[model samples]
Target chain A: MEHRPMIALVGNPNAGKSALFNALTGAHQKVGNYPGVTVERKLGRLALPDGRAADLIDLPGTYSLDAKSPDEQVTRNVVFGHQEGERRPDLIVIVVDAANLDNHLRFTLELIALGSPCIVALNMVDLATRDGLELDADQLSQDLGAPVIPTVAVRRRGLDDLKAAMVQGIPQHAAPLPVHSEHAAPDADELRRKAREIARRAIVAETPTRRITSQIDRVVLNPVAGPLILLALLFVIFQAVFAWSEAPIAMIEETFAALQTGVEAVLPEGFLRDLIVQGVINGVGSVVVFLPQILILFFFILMLEATGYMTRAAFLMDGLMARVGLSGRAFIPLLSSFACAIPGIMATRTISDPKDRLTTILIAPLMTCSARLPVYTLIIAAFIPSTSVWGGIGLQGLVLFALYVAGIFGAVVVAMLLRIGVIKGPGGSFLMELPKYQMPLLRDVIIGLWQRAWIFLRRAGTIIFVTTIILWLLLSFPKPPAGSDQSLVEYSAAGRIASVLEPVLRPIGFNHEIALALIPAMAAREVAVSALATANAIEESEDEDETARTLGERLQGRWSLPTALAFLAWFVFAPQCLSTIAVARRETNGWRWPLFMTAYLFALAWLGAGATYWTAVAFGL
Target chain B: MRLTSLEPNHPAYVESIDWNAMSEMDSRRLRELGLHEGASIELLHRAGFTGRGAYACRIGRMIVAMRAAHAGAISVRTGAE
Candidate 1:
């Protein structure tokens, strides 16, 4: 007997449940993994008008309590109080899309039959009414045992009524008797028959409407035109990633340069000055400058997802993915890796097939995440000119596009190899809902972009900040004797370390400085640019004005055109980030796959970079 | 007939699920999707390489996309034309 009740929000996928949850919880939310599963459990605090604050958990969305998928299993287990650490909810909030009530209510009636204290939030009621369909809430509430409240989640309408209905618990006698089942659940025919009867009594009017979404799908989902639009959309996104980020990137660099100049002018020459200017400002600035590009890339991804095109894109890629031994369900997790591999890897839980999930996880890191943008942009700007390719497309943009293509090709090749080897299995089914296209809301897009930018900046403020300070100390310690003509950093501990690593890395054209930068870079791929900026900045601290040259120009002057190409090739396959490996270890629940992933990626990166360097050198560049 | 053989945009009723043709998980998955006997299905769209492709079908209020390989495991009937 808990004093405060725990309410769980459960719903079918695409039912506006998350929207309602977001509205009710606002900012009082915690997102974490369910016990022994990677599926995210989003919990929040809600205050009732009766002055009691309740704990609210948003369970994973599923079509039924049939528990076919991991997400559905979690939802069913949590609701039934079978999941470890998840208490049976004191009350259940069943969210049903107002327009899709017939399909949604089958699951709703099942929950109602469970004889729990529950309320039906007929979400997206505004949409239903707009289509000339009116839902009599009281009548529906009478037909079903629980109180039914019409809600428009996104607009925040009827939320207070929802809150009131939830807190004012209905009498136990109000609910109908549970429906008995043969398969422990009704077959398709029985469920549909019951659902139609319920709809007949509950819903008053209906329009046999062919929604505008289906009309648009006619062209967009057309066999030939669908793939073409997808390609064109991707091309535009890549162009925008390059074309849109230029001004913001330059402004950030200039700001950092000014800040460095300001610090140098105010302080007397000392190690403290070096740490502040080189360690903190320059190192962190290098990575933070990619924020614009990351935001642009994620904006496009969110828009595609919000508009329902992402699922269709998966449908389109199914045949192509099958060749790589992946189901269409793998598309989402693979696409998600373009943002970061951590979430991408965790997202594989949705792919029910173990071998398919493992293969998806193995190749996810090769998707050219936004973290690699800083390093890629740095090398590309220095090596590839701003010249146009075909009247409008910048050479830089085309190269960026080519790099992404390289990653996709690499992932496919790797997945194919895995399928043929250790992870070999029969083809898995790809079954998923293709949600009707909706206009992506401005609010959701802004929120998505904000979250991405916040994550990037938070990383810059924490991990990059601490690591850069350590890098500065390593690059500064072991001072030379006062009279020695040699520079102080030449005698630093990092100097010796770099020299030792240089020989082994030289075949791929990495010099001692690049070798030193590679050490801290294992913490994060973007750290390579920050570390590179720090290493080069210390070398040029003697001539502060020349430091005005962009880190790209400095890298250009030191590393040859071949080395830059080799570096880009290395990064494409590089297993640089330790966090991704740690996450993979946790997700797979073993050390074997993560270890194998790291070993294979390292070999691929080293050999690939070596070949590129030698080939470019042979061309006499 | 197999689901892939169904005409696009034409309504068909699921008559029986071919359990032996697909994996057990797939058979269970299809039933979970309301694709068992008496459920209505309309092949809204098909996309992929010509012979082998994924089919997007509307079954009740849900639109599901599945590969033709998985589609071949399902049998359906249409009202007499």
Candidate 2:
């Protein structure tokens, strides 16, 4: 068997590299992480015209080989064969934005200087043509001493030519890689000058065409109207996440509920039945039900990213974010945190500065992710009345809105404090390119959404599934004495553990039941609701007489208003989700920051709960 | 005049850049984006409440956003000036 040639796709940011990679490789892509780094590794198989297949790796988008962030460092290391667990590519396909040739060609020139066999895919040729720029690929190929193929990656144009060029260019066997030191760091300024000259020579004709992007940016980035439009857009997204997802969420809930009921009927009245119904169905269902909201939030996020509007949103939010000592770049990640912090924390890779990224990671949990919704709604329904207050706002709606605002407010304060204390530094520079707007390909958007959904489901299947089984076993075994008056839950191991946890939680107005729920809730924050229902001995199925009253009524009958309020406050600051902590550890590359994050968040949760509990008691609520 | 002082939509040529005015990483970014002396540029948009937080400019067919502070480091010459 001849060795499969390894080909790499390299480009400056927004150079349409990924789209071209998707077009060439189609569905044969494997996404993973580089060992010891958070940068994503995308590998696919490129089928050659000749009966052979080559491995194609899509490296991260970068401006130059001169590394700044970890993401950029991965690209540089991989291209130079220094990256561990990655073989040196046999060929490099440099993707450059055709319209931005003068700027992109600078990086292309630097890559060419590496003395590696290279081909240039002049991407986004359609957009360039629309901008009334005509380019001669032959002249550009001659000027750079590399083959240039004009491609519109999103439209799958020129992919055949690009693939053919790749097959002919990539070596069959491993070639002795050039020493990265041999490049001696080509002067970037000189490369820019050379790139400009080459680009000028390649352009056969040009006309000053009006760009729709600038026209849109004029209104979108307007000092007066930009912020308003952004806020309105966010309002619509939040409304949609809750409103549009209602039907699907109900369907998911009913499906799981029915599954639990079916298991109870089919299985014998023993450990397996209890484990399947309560442990598997209820435990995972609590999290799986969040899928609709997550998908909805990600759809908008993916569209924003594809449409080239994410940067504009960031630009508009820069002013407000700056007030908190963060740049506009942090805005998108923080916004994503509203739907889920796991992705939000992952999104922080866009913040190149270490301090900026760290600070954003720490405060992301304060954004009130969708996981906390069930707990909040349960408590609010049980405690706050539905009567209108202050004209037409329902008191329940006001409380929910206040909780969201509280999270944002807490995030603001924590960000400022972190900037001044722990992660102190001059603010990171917010230098970004606002790419021209284009219609995102439907195929690309679907692929992106699928990847995000798969990641979320995998987490639910593995970590949440295992933790639920353990918690169920702890609650199920050592059956209460034959005539015992104690309920099964109160007689279990978890009940005994909750007794010890009760003392610590007492100051914050929590009872034995709340303590029992808090333990399993550590796996995922949404589990708090199911755990609470179990502690109260409330049947989870809908047909039971007790279940007819709903979890809200059960909570209302058992807990004081102050305790419910305190629980809400606790969740607002609590870093209770294990997955979030794990992701923070991965993204930061160590236990140090994630551990610090957990510690501070726990401290805040305790203090906030205590204060809210005491304040509610004082007010005689 | 500093690039930040250039009125929006006024095309200008970069006269000189005071790379010493900012962090080395930021200066590298500016240079990498072709914001050096002799590059033609036009201020396209100003964002934020004060309109001083971030500035958008066009350089070589790309629109780039940078904080006003970074823009203040480069000097530019409009035709009239």
Candidate 3:
């Protein structure tokens, strides 16, 4: 039996490791969860020139082997064969940024210290050359005592050479280098000195690129103009989300309406018919309608991240964060929250300081995640007038922007309070390496957006789908009294529960309809739209106007402008999603912080809603 | 002298690093600074808030951070001559 070697691909964050892996493995890749952790492990087999297959594992990106974060720790463990049941990699392929070899070499040296057979994949050579970088591949290879192959992972450049190098089995030579105390167990000074000496012999730069990046950075990264640019970018993105997604959203809505009508026409008027048409179709439709908006949000985020603007944005925001006693490193995790709070909360592990991590966890949920897009869209579409100002800033976009701003403000306030009250510690320093700007790989951007969309749909199909069905059953069963004109729902268990809860919610502007919606919204905020559709008997209607007219008429004389505003206000601060709470619990390592977060958000929502309602009544709007 | 006061382009030599005085993580970070006893470093650039400054310098093959306080500690021989 021929024994195949195991190969590991490693690089810095967003260094095209995945793209290279995909290029090499193509359709042979399988993605699975890493044992007990949620971190995804991508493994595949690549054919060697000799016709033998080698196993390839694409490890998570890490800055160095110091293992500051969980992702980094996992990478460290896997590469060193510390992970249980995992064989040590026969060869380590160090993916270096050809454009930014200075930063990339830090990891290279660290990996060299591990004494693994290694090859350097100089990725993004195209970008490096475009930026006027020159590299003598042979000289670099000779210097480092390893084969150096130039590769453009996005363009699939030098992949064959890389494969050939791997197949040839590059010799492992331990170069004399300085080992920092943090890296190994002993001889820190000696090791670091040796590492420097090796670097002096191996690495050579034609011209320093930092000066150019810094010169460009002065203008774009200026504190005053930088924030303005950031705000302008965000405003444009929000506007685009509403403008670009409108047609697709309308198409989805119409498709679902047509499907609902078809189902109602074919099935008999009974509980099963209603369950299929009104419950399942409507429930799933409500979630699906928000997909375009979610995709749009992700598209812009990926673009911004790809363009290398995110690091500058984080750098600009560092001063403000320091004022509130939070480190700038919290920016990435908090920004991730805009897509979903679960991963956002989980990403807080990057912060080495425990107190800073907790502070970041507390504020992450306030970053208007994609899940809240449906609630915001539903409320804004129903209440806010559709108009444009200053060329094409849509009114709906304006409202969405305001809601995002409100969430950000709420998060900052919460962070400030937490710093002063609970986890008080001196603010630590911020250190980050800003990479050179490069055009994002379309393949990676598309894959990222696809993964986000799939995750959203999966949640809807599983948790939201099951919860909606249960809710429909609860609101449909326990038939109404005979000879009574009341709908069957008025006598159902859900109706009784809402009626009992109505008194407590009435002062805050919640009617039975909204109250009923809230119960299912707890499962997922977007489900409230489906619940409202079911309760109003609007899902079975053939005409859009009939459904809209009935819902509008039912809510017409009952809800004042203040009541609608109050409802919007409530959702802005409402802790309605259970997944967020569960994630918060896991991130914080106890129920204490999640409980406090839920309580504060709930109280804030109620107070804000109550105040809006009363104030609207006073103004007679 | 604090690192915050180091003039851009000036060369500095680290005399010593008191790893025990810093937090474990901060100490680890200091070790990565390439300042382990007699390494020569230069301040390449500084842009951001003056109070909590963010600087960039080359250490081995990496451009790593040198906090204002840490930067100040390295005794420098000005290259202006």
In candidate 2 chain A, what residue range of length 10 has the lowest lDDT sum?
A540-549
**Chain A TM-score from candidate 2:** 0.97
- Native-referenced DockQ of model 2: 0.81
Residues A496-581 of candidate 1: C-alpha lDDT, one tens digit per residue: 78788899899889888788777767777877765676566545443323442477787778889999998999899995587788
TM-score of each: 0.87, 0.97, 0.85
DockQ of each: 0.65, 0.81, 0.28
Best by DockQ: 2
Q: How well does candidate 2 score on lDDT at residue A134?
A: 97
Question: lDDT score of model 1?
Answer: 0.80
Candidate 2 C-alpha lDDT tens digits along A5-54 = 99999999999988998888887888888998889999999898877889
User: Order of candidates by DockQ, top first?
Assistant: 2, 1, 3
lDDT of 3 at B48: 59
| Local distance difference test values of all predictions, in order | 0.80, 0.88, 0.72
Top candidate (TM-score): 2
Positional deviation of residue A434's Cα in model 3 after best superposition, in angstroms: 0.9
What local lDDT score does residue A183 receive in model 1, on the 0 to 100 scale?
51
CA-only RMSD, every prediction: 4.1, 1.8, 4.6
lDDT digits (tens) for residues A183-217 of candidate 3: 35434445555545544554455555455555666
